[model samples]
Target chain A: MAQQVIIKVDNLVKKFGNFTANDNLTFEVFKGEIFGFLGANGAGKTTALRILCGLSSPTSGQVEVAGFDVYKQTNKIKMNIGYMSQKFSLYEDLTVRENIRFFAGIYGLSRKIIRERTDELLNKLNIEELGDKLISSLPLGWKQKLSFSIAIFHRPQIVFLDEPTGGVDPITRRQFWDMIYDASNDGITVFVTTHYMDEAEYCNRVSIMVDGRIEALDTPETLKKTYNAKNMNEVFLMLARK
Target chain B: MDNPAISIENIIKSYDKVVALDDISFEVDKGELFGLIGPDGAGKTSLFRILTTLLIQDSGNAIVEGFNVVKDYKKLRTIIGYMPGRFSLYPDLTVEENLRFFATIFNTTIEDNYDLIKTIYRQIEPFKKRLAGNLSGGMKQKLALSCALIHKPEVLFLDEPTTGVDAVSRKEFWEMLKELQKKDITILVSTPYMDEASMCDRVALIQNGRILEVETPEEIVKLYPHSLWAVISSDMYKLESDLQSFEKSVSVYRFGDSIHLSVKDDDIYGSDIKEYLESKNQNKIKVEKIDANIEDCFMALMNNNDL
Candidate 1:
């Protein structure tokens, strides 16, 4: 029924000593759907993303990722998901194809699939000529798209992309999301965080965070309608100022 | 003292074997607010650094306020104000102290040029006693900008000045730049945001260390080659792949929830493209011929260049 709720997070509270980063947070991301988790910088988006990725543990409250309890089954969750962070997460010294191979190996992908996928990804990006080129040699736009493709190459059940399009051109960012859509269509759940308001409008459902808690959670249209706003920027402004 | 603000001819800059700028030639009219619109590593920073005498170009020449970047760097340094992309204020120094330090570097006092930066300085006046690093991002932007304007340089160089700040801060920062331009100062700012390109009097879209197109934002958008459509459906991914199968598909680029398609012919309408989508299992498809903005033109130009 409804894919049995692939991710269920309940009142997840994460604090750094006296400072509360994620306060009384609760959310659920169903399987086979794009769930966007968005927030301003220092609003606890990264804190929550780190917790969900099993990179860090919540200070309190129940949490689960891909049916694995974050407290006890972090490695299992890691295997079921892929993460592309805001920072350039790939090795600069590695070639485009080599980065793909390295990330694939970390996820226990076979050599044959890695080879096939690397070629396919390179071809899809229309940059197969640059496959052997150093990652540093490519433009930031190309590097971001390549890093995005490599992150989800292992075909995990869920992929977490944090600000995947920051600092890229509109064309490159456009193409990057196309590949994201291709993956989600193949039944991979996308749990992404972004500061780009335009990108948030693409999600099936999005939760806007403010002051360590969800201020809004709904489809773009629903949030827009509820707040009597014309664009996502206004809706965010209304919520942030409130 | 009497030059057309800035002028460049066949400017080429490289870092060792890597070419950062390739035969770039552009000029900023006297008191004009010119913009360099491109992504990271697009050489906007390199060009700014060269114009400000911070980095020397490999070849060609540039003149800023009658001073050359290579031959008259010391003279150029005294006449140009530069605010770098990153916030480069001293963490330990207070806002007032930082301002004073920059004033001292230019052989001037804050009191001498306080009138020039009065409007911007007022915003950070309350936090003047606070450590530069302790201020918020928006506040730090104001402080950095105020310090740059402390000496009242004849030409201003701002490199990616609004990145990482909120939309509100970006808007506010641009407003401040416009006010600065009105004081008979030549302003040159570089940014990655396509939307910000319109705020300038003219912009140059650069890529791969090459200048793609240089024109006003409205003129660039007006010259877009093809008719555009924003198509959306239930199965968005398939819509992208299937749109390629249609005869009208020239190029498909994902834009938020919709796929913006550029077609070959004007007579081949969206209705015809809709029928093709129906055959591909995408329902409730909406399509229309819409206006192409600056970003669309940037991509179209990029596509044309690639071909």
Candidate 2:
């Protein structure tokens, strides 16, 4: 049995002026795998993520997302992937139901499908009563959970989550990871970036970026054993310090 | 007894209908590294604001360096340094300009207090001419700390200083904080990172504007009342759901490669869990009784509070 590679990047280089933001990165994300993108601040994680999300083009290299070429099929790539960041997830003024409907519509879902999915999503989250309430009024944890649900609402082949659980409670954070696992179980490839080391350990495999380069990419257990470190935090400190 | 660096006596703060801080009280001794750990909307920022004299509490009182927060706010301001959760430095100003501006406002020259911020300032010296807004996240944080320390206050308050910072930079920032504490400056820092709590001499685990426990990290970890077990199997997700359905499971949380399960009964052995999961056809199951860390203690406290 062969694993399906949903995102393929080979010698990917992204430069901004003279600075190489992503330097010769190569990695493949398989279907239904939770890929953890770990990096220090200013380590090109954002640049690579932007490139993968089709918001920016790569400087050089072969890149494919959802079977679409990065250079020529950016729109198709965007259509096939979902993105949610902690900074921008949902419209604050819009009601929960409205935010869901708007994003579903943007994803080109039909009116009938959007209507049905909205109810299903609200009920699944057990927030059916709060559907009419504005997103701004919801708690941070609730908003974050709802944002994640909406991000995968269109059923994109891959969902990019950027620090999706930042500043949430421990229980809520674990619940959020459980949701990620559920998404992976449902066959959506999860590509995420987080500063929390524990969250990094939750990934099926993790790639640590250093100075705009992929310094290490492997399962957390292997990485920990290879580095002789107790946990991902020590592994990160060891690699990042170097 | 000698005067504690900072003291809060039943400090209560609210806005309209929202109670930001509910009779919060704590004390930090002089030259101690104290951490206020909690999630966002935990009223950390509100408490910081009140102590820094930026906002007034609706009731109760706070004292910093023996100066009343309300009555002697002016005096308190002159002796305390505050780095807000958000970047409050002038974004348009150059790094050097911002540091110098902060120095001037404190009735001191850059040269007069250069030694106080020497270590932090030296790192940002190359970027002295760069606009504060243009610096990277890590560099911006370094610059902010430099500016905060330019006045060399006896007490420092850092609100979520490492919130969005990466692991490497966060380690470096804590090193800087440790360096600062050596100078006999009382430091009060807040962060959502549970791992960082161990670095502090003592920590106050706060949630919902109320303090859950204030003790050394070791003491806090010792407070976890349940025996924890780490369980892993072929199916990670199913392992979590299955553990949740277990009759004796009190709480089941996904922790990295394994599920940390707390049984309702303490005497439940690892073999018992293994047998149950094996019955469910979970392969390669590994179960071990493990000690709790700060995060586990925090989760237990949070759950108990909810109940």
Worst 10 residues of 1 chain B by lDDT: B298-307
lDDT (10s digit) by residue, model 2, range B1-307: 7889998999988888788899998899999999999999899999999999999999998999999999999999999999998998999999989998999999988899888888888988998999999998888888888888888899999999999889888988999999999998999999999989999999999998899899999888876777789998988868888998889988898776678998766888999999999988899999999988888888988887321
Candidate 2 C-alpha lDDT tens digits along A1-242? 99999999999999999999999999999999999999998899999999999889999999999999989999999899999999998999999989999999998999999999888988888878999999988889999999999999999999999999889999999889878989999999999999999889899899999999999999999999999998899999999986
Worst ten-residue run, lDDT, model 2 chain B?
B298-307
Best by DockQ: 2
Kindly list the per-residue Cα lDDT of model 1 for residues A153-227, writing each as its tens digit.
877888898878767777778777777777888898998876566787778898988889999899988999999
Which docking category, incorrect, acceptable, medium or high, applies to candidate 2? medium
The regions of model 2 sitting more than 4 angstroms off are B305-307
Clashes of each: 0, 0
Q: Over the stretch B197-241, how does candidate 1's per-residue lDDT look in tens digits?
A: 889999888877888888888888878787789898987767878
Best by TM-score: 2
What's the distance in Å from true for residue B64, model 1? 1.3
